[model samples]
Target: MKKVKPKDIKGHIEYLADDRLLGRMPGTEGYKMAADYVIDKFKSMGIEPAGENGSYLQDVTIRKAVTGNDATFISRDSLGNKSELIHGKDFVIFPNAVEKQTTLEAPLVFAGFGISAPEIGYDDYAGIDATGKVVVVMRGAPDSFTSTVAASSMDIGNILQTAANHGAVGVVMAFTNPTAGVPNISRGVNSVLGPDGGIAVSRYYVSDDVKLFSFISGETLTNFLAKAGLDFNTSLTSLKNATPVSAPLNTTIRASYSSSHEDINSYNVIGKITGSDPLLKNEFVIHSAHLDHVGIGAPVNGDSIYNGAHDNASGVASLLEIARIYSRIDAKPKRTVLIAMVTGEEMGLLGSSYFAKYPTVPKQNIVANINTDMPTIIAPLLSVVALGAEHSTLDKPVANAASYLGLDVEEDPEPEQNRFVRSDQYSFVSQGIPALHIKYGNKTPDGKNNLNEQVQVWREKYYHKPQDSIDGTFDFDAGKTYVQLNFLIGYQVAQNPERPSWNPGDFFETAR
Candidate 1:
């Protein structure tokens, strides 16, 4: 087996994170350049094209929905007094992805966290009748819920679906922070389009029944709750305590919005290494990483380009090195290894979601996915956190791989980050494929083992900022270790006869 080289990893990152790539945003020439770079590398490594039409590229049509100026939100009190809320100040409406124009007038109901999980013994909609009404919710789950459960419950898609299940006409997310402003959708919301032209996957719109999805400023929510004979802080306290305070508000909201959409095309670059065993080769093990980033953004310290060096350039580099490692080996694993450098992850896992749902190969033949995204390789690779591994049989491979690499496997130190659902691996997990993403654990040779603290400091300065360029902190040796560890994990899965399986009664088992 060929060892992953730090110099090769450095080379890939240096080229990908160069300023010319313009942050590798989807639907840009810069993004095409980055994709073509991956294609060339795969070709050089003799990796077979496993994308659509026997090419290295898979089409991912992205629809960008921009809220029009005609958007309006009017609130009416029980006495018929109406007040028009200012857009961008009091609230911001998400553009309707399906409907060009939509209008809804309905009574409002406060649904705590908008979660309805009876299995977990919590249903915010138990007492509230949200039928044909607008449901206002805070973006959170009870503290008693696990991190993955909490993240999935609070997901915008799940929230909208939950509201729709209760026959709610709309969903309005209230800002929890007193100083926080409404979200700005000026750049527009993004969603993927299936071959038939309908929405394949989205974070905002669940169905036409849920016409309105918007966010209100903290002050706006406070005043609205006040008129409903409820205190914002008190209601929040009650909800946080799992008391589930839900009631019909005294105010009615009338909302009208028009959306303008612009569809842009992107690609998910895929390549594969065929396995040796005839039967097992029919099944596949996936390696995935996001190829797109936040693109160019507002200037930070005079640098405008949001070069995603650590954000994902390092991840793509790691995958490429993994491909190279496979290329050098004479013996292949029993199961095919599919390397998928996906797109639109920063926009909400669009590319991976599409591929996981509609894979280039037979979906059932896919056994497992090992995702790499922003490994935060700023420190030594002493230990690892295998996100999502514990939920499935993939945990064994992760543990064995970590042990083989002379690394310890630890529980996630920052579960509050909700990283399991924040990356490409969640797409696979959501599609019922057991997956895991490896991240650096808090361990150091100095015995401090406070790497999480150091990562926090690094994140404060660079996580998504333009400062995350090639010039930022990097331990290329750590990058090499990540590549090796991830490659070994996938290799073991590919070689194993029994495919990776979900743990009994796992949270994601029901998804399958």
Candidate 2:
């Protein structure tokens, strides 16, 4: 097998992160340039096109919804007193992706975390009858739940669907931190549109029935809860302790909003390497990385382009190197390998979700996905955290690969970040396919292993900013190691006869 070279990884990043790409934001000519670059590289490597119509491009239509100025939110108490809240100050409304205009007037029901997972013996909607009402929920799960499960529980899409399933007309997500401000939706919300021009997947706007989805400031929530004779802190404490505090609020909210949408075209670049075994070749192992980033933003330090060198340029580069390694090998793995550089990941994993839902190949034939995003290869590659791997038999391959590479495998040191469900891997996991994302762990050459601390400093400086250009901090050797580690893990799965399976009685297995 040919070894991955650090210089090659650097070369790929140098081009992808160049200022000419303009951060590779989807729907822009710069993004098309990046897609063309990937296609050209894949073609040169002899990788077969595995995208739509035998080409390397999968069409994705992204709909961006912006809330109109006519949006209004008014809270009326049972005593007939009304208080109209200011938009963008007290709260911010999420644009209705499906409907151009939406209006709703309903009573509010506080449903602790808005999670309905009975397998874990925790259901926030247990006793609450949220019929024809708006559910007010905090953003968190019970402390006892596993990291991945907790992240899934707090997912906005799941929360909205759960609310809709219970006959709720709307949802209001209250901030957990009293000092936290309402989310800034100035750039509008994004959703994937199906071939029929309907919503295929979205983090917001669950369905037509769920008309209103908004976020309230933590201070405003405290006042709202107070009107119902409930202390916000006490209710939050009870919910966090898994005690399930829910009730009908004394206040009813009336909200009206108009949404305007702009549709943009994007693409997911895909390449394939056929397997050697005839039967095993039917199944595939996916290697995915996002090729998009937050475009030009408010200038910082006199720079505007948000070149995502470490955010994902490095990740895409790693996948390129992995593809090259396969090209240099004489004998291929038993199962096919699909290298997917998806777009619209920065826009809420839109590209990956679309591909996962409507893959070029049969969805069931896909056994596992190994995703790479923001490896943060600034320090020596000493340890790794295989996010989402523990939920399935993919953990074995991760262990074997780590052992082969002499890298330690450790638990996520920053579980509070909710990283498992934050990236493209979650898109596959949501579709019932086993998947995992490789992330840097807290390990360093010096025994202190305080790499996480260093990463925090780096993140503050360059993460998602113009400073994230190719000139940013980088350890190319670490990038080379990451490529090898991820390639080995996927190679083992491709060689194995039995398809990778979810762990016995795992949450994902039973849930699916």
Candidate 3:
């Protein structure tokens, strides 16, 4: 194995995260520069181009929506009293609807957690008839759940689809963990939905036609629950215990929204190393990373650029190093290797979804995907967290890689984040591809910072902020090690004759 140098890794990060790249926003000139750099690197290494049209770039068209100011909502109680709810304060509209302007006047019914799982004998919408009405649900699944059920329930897209299947005209989400009554709406419409072949893409085609969607404030939700003779806290506890209590608040809601959209274009940089074995070359082991980050945002600490140095610039840098290492190897692996630096991942996993739905290579030919999103290397790595590791046959390989590095591989520490559904790996998983999303553990092996306070501090201080750029706090050695782990796992997958497969009877296996 060729040694990867810290300086080489740092150099790549410095260039990609530089302010001159303007945060590498999708479809921007800065992002184009980054794409050009990736393609040039692929060419210089003599890696074969595998993108559409005999090029190293797959075009992903994007649509940007700007919500108009005319959006409004009004609430009416059973006693015939009307109150207007202010937009941006009481609620925020979901922007995925295709219609530019829509209005819905319907009754709102509280649907415990909006989950319908017959396999688990739990259906939140069981006795509730939500047809031609509005359905309100809590943001997350019940706290008490089996690991499998919890994973499925955390997929919000699936939750909304279930609500639509019940014939609900609109869906309202009440965040269990409210952020000061202001829903954390992305400043940009990053949802991978709708038509016109834009930046947003998905593995399964979901209906985005549920036009009336909103997230109400905690206070608003409490008020509604009060009128329905349900204590908010008591009801939440009951739901967590699986004794769901769903009822109508004897209230009606009226909402109107409008938005304007524009077409934008981005690219996914792709290249491959052809295998020597004729038969194995037909199958590919993919190494992927997202290149886009949240572009310029509100000024923070007197700086405007949200340079995603650690958020993902580090990840792309790792892919480049992996590519370099594979290109220099004398004896090529039996199976082909694909390198994809996708775009609009920060937007909504758009680039990867597009690739998954319209793969340049036959989708069946893809064996496995290894993804690196954001790697935090505050201290020397002692542990590795492999998201979705146990769901497939990759656990042994990843554990073996960690063992080779004298590190212990563990499951995700913060499952509440629902990380499995958050990254680019989800795009592949939704399509039945066995994948792993790797990250450096929060604690050291010796138990120093074992609680992962360092990472918590980073999230609070630099995550998605201008301060994420390289600084004294950054550790180059840890970053190099993280990249090595990815190399080890991918190399093993490419060398093995049998393609990685999903665990028998796993939820994802059903996708196949």
Candidate 4:
């Protein structure tokens, strides 16, 4: 077996993270160029094409939608008083549908958190019928929500899907304050399945014409609910305590929107190395990474390119190194190895979702997925955090990999981020495939907070910004460590006799 070198990994990152790539936006020329680079590498390494039609590129169509600024939402109370809520100030429409105009006038029903996780005995939509009404929901899961379950189990997707399942005409996200950082929906890419992919709110709801979605600040929501003698804070607290706080408000919401959509195309590059053993070769393990970033957005500090050097270029670089090492192995592992470089991850995991829904290989035969979305190379490696580690047997392999490098394996440090559901691996997990998202652990061996500080600095400054360039700070040595860790995990899984399975009683296992 040939070991990967730090220079080899850095070379991949430097090439993919070049400013000339224009952040490698999905469906754009830069994205295609990046895909071509990966295809070339795979072909040069003699990796067989695993994409569609005997090619290494799987074409995925994406749709971009921009909401009209003139959209309006008016609400009328029982007292016959009406108020016109300005867009972007009072409320912002969710840009998930391809509708020319949408008009929905219905009474408001406050569904606390809008979650329906029966396993946890928390059902905000229970005992309530949202049929033909606009459901007002808080902006997050119940405070009691835990990462022990599937990350998407109680997320906004679940909330919207549940609301749609109950026949709701429209959905409104009520934030506690304007500072809730509600994303501006004026610009976004609509998913082929739904706005945010089919993870939660599938195309079923959109096809049913239940597409009204708006966001309101806490003050706006509180004043609106106050007209009906309801308290937003109290409702939120009750929901966290597993108490239902759904109620009907004597108000009617009339939301109208117009949008325009343009079709776009991207690709996911796939290649495989068939295993030596016939039976085990049929069962494959996937090493995946996203190749797309935020692309070129608003310029910052005289820079216009969001190079995404560390955000995802780091992850893709590691994937290339892993593929290189695998190609050099004299005797391949017992199980086939698949390399997946997905696109449109920055736009709500669209590429990965497409792959998961319609896999190049049979979805069931793919035993496991080990994903590296973003591995911080700004500090010395101390530990590794594996998302979804606890959900399946992959945790053992992950721990073993980390231990091999004298590093400890840990769970997600910030579960509130819902990271497990944020990356490409979750797309596979939703399809009942056990997957883990690998990252450099937050803590260091000395227990000092320096590592965390460096992470924070990167996030605050370069994350999704034009400043994310190859010239920025980086610890290539640290990058090499995590890359080796990922390779080890894939090697162990590929040679193992049995496929990895979700742990008994795990929420995701039960979800499947």
RMSD of each: 1.9, 1.3, 2.8, 2.9
Q: Give the TM-score of candidate 4.
A: 0.93
Question: What Cα-based lDDT does every candidate model obtain?
Answer: 0.91, 0.93, 0.80, 0.79
Deviating ranges (above 4 Å) for candidate 1 = 178-180, 226-228
Clashing pairs in 1: none
Per-residue lDDT for 253 in model 1?
A: 92
lDDT (Cα, tens digit) per residue for candidate 4, span 348-456: 7878877887888888799999999888788888887888877789989888888878887766776666788888898888789999888767676577735656677
Q: Which one wins on TM-score? A: 2
lDDT of 1 by residue, 263-331 (tens): 989989999999999899999999999999888989999999999999899999999999999999899
The number of the candidate with the highest lDDT is 2
TM-score of each: 0.95, 0.98, 0.91, 0.93
Candidate 2 lDDT tens digits, 1-512: 24788999999999999999999999998899999999999999999999999899999999999999888999998899999999998999999999998889999988988988887688889998999999998888888888999998898988999999999999999878877679899889999999999999898977889999999999888887888788888888888888888888889999999999999999999999999999999899999999999889999999999999998999999999999999998999999999999999999999999999899999999999999999998989999999999999999999999998899999999999999989999999989999999999898998999899999999999998999988999999999999999999999999999999998888888776
Model 3: weakest 10-residue lDDT segment is 197-206
> 3 or 4, which is superior by TM-score?
4
Which residue runs of candidate 3 sit more than 4 Å off their true CA positions? Answer: 77-79, 146-152, 177-180, 184-186, 191-208, 442-451, 510-512
Clashes of each: 0, 0, 4, 0
